[model samples]
Target: MKRFINKWWRGRIAKLDLCPLPKALAPLENGRVLIFAPHQDDETIGCGGTLALLRKNGCEVKAVFVTDGGGAGGLPEGTVAIRKKEAAAALAVLGVDDLVFLDEPDGSFRNTLGFEQKIMAILDQFQPDWLFMPSVLDYHRDHVAIGQALYACWRRWQGTARAFFYEIWSPLPATWVVDISSVAELKRSALSRYELPLAHCDYLSASMGLAAYRGLYLSCNGQSGLAEAFVEAENNGIWSGISERMLALRIYFEKLLKR
Candidate 1:
């Protein structure tokens, strides 16, 4: 039954001719892009390829790691410093020089007033054309929290910045996809920098595989390519509806992540 539904849904979307596969190529050059990660490695896992593509197209890119990444999410204690180092190396491969570390608690992100203020401060300062964050439907609590907080910040600020939500532990209902076949190797190298986290989870292979899957049906020829999925931030009515539905199941998801 699930398989049938999935096939029917794919078939329904396949008929569309949105830029030849729902591809978004706006502001492809000379744009400001800001990305926020719940952990040291989430940035790379979520949109490393898009980061590379953006830099290649001359976009000013800034990445912010929202957590210390220590003794949480299966990582060991005292690993925060090392993870930051790893992040520097990984982002370097993507040609990202501007980085920020918020040093908030790992696996424990609350949408507190202070937290929202910090996030909004960056929005005011950077004034990014594109803001990258994790998807609210992601499996991890940290991912969801960061996404929600970012959403809330945008709500209050109501700035011109556009939000692009990426997939990590959960697949997003993508509004568009960015072809990253040109920088697939760069993304692979970036993912390889985090040896410690790779040991815990094979994100390199998983991310690459997901990218391939995203590109498989959308590619021009029979050859398979790599792409990254992004769901643009919806308007207030739609976004509020989605958030309310997700929050209704917060208790269940929290228990699942904790266990």
Candidate 2:
């Protein structure tokens, strides 16, 4: 039933009258991107293709793992250490050399000053042109906490950077989609580096299929392929292509329904 629902919604998304936003908002050139992942492997799952695309376009990308991912069960005492190693491997596969780990306790992430300070320090130092964090609507407590932290930080910083939210184990009300069609394989390879926990789950194929669906929606609307989606929280002078993409998606999904 879960699979059926997912498929049903996927097809509905295809027929959506999408209004894709312009590409100018996500300008890859002369931009610094900081991807904040709640766990070690999320960077690859959520934005690996974007990382690869940015790298290919000569953009600077840095990743920060917010937690050690020690509480997902199945660890044999030194699980955090193993997860860190696996994370390193995954980043290396994606060609992202700049990485940082907050080393915070997994499954207990909170929106406290201590946590905010650590993230603030990184943001101040990096001063990224763009920031990516988990969606606020995620089902996981840690994910939602991280999103709140980022939101608070962004507000404190007066929205200095372009902030976007990615999805993981949750459904994001997407306002923008980035075509990652060319780098989908690279994303798959990067995701494959996390052999510990993901090896036991069926995430890769489903994730890829989602990307494909997003791509098809973009293509039908006369845009690029393989895509990652996000919702724009604040648009202060940033010309995000959200409205355009949404229109395109709506039309695509409507057309699919006619078929």
Q: Relative to the true structure, how large is the alpha-carbon lDDT of every model?
A: 0.84, 0.77
Tens digits of per-residue lDDT for model 2 on 90-188? 888777899898877788887778888888888889988888988766666687778778776776774378888887775567767788877888889
What TM-scores do the predictions have?
0.84, 0.79
Over 1-259, each residue of candidate 1 has an lDDT whose tens digit, in order, gives 9999999999999998675445544336889999999998899998999999999999999999998888455655668988999999999999998999988998777778888888888999998988888888888888888888888787778678788889998787677888788899999999999988898789799999999988864555443578888878765788788776765576577788678
Candidate of highest lDDT: 1
> What global local distance difference test value does model 2 have?
0.77
Lowest summed-lDDT stretch of 10 residues in model 1? Answer: 19-28
Model 1 error, position 99 (Å): 0.6
Q: Pick the candidate with the highest TM-score.
A: 1
What value does the lDDT take at residue 99 in candidate 2? 86
Off by over 4 Å in 2: 1-27, 72-74, 235-259
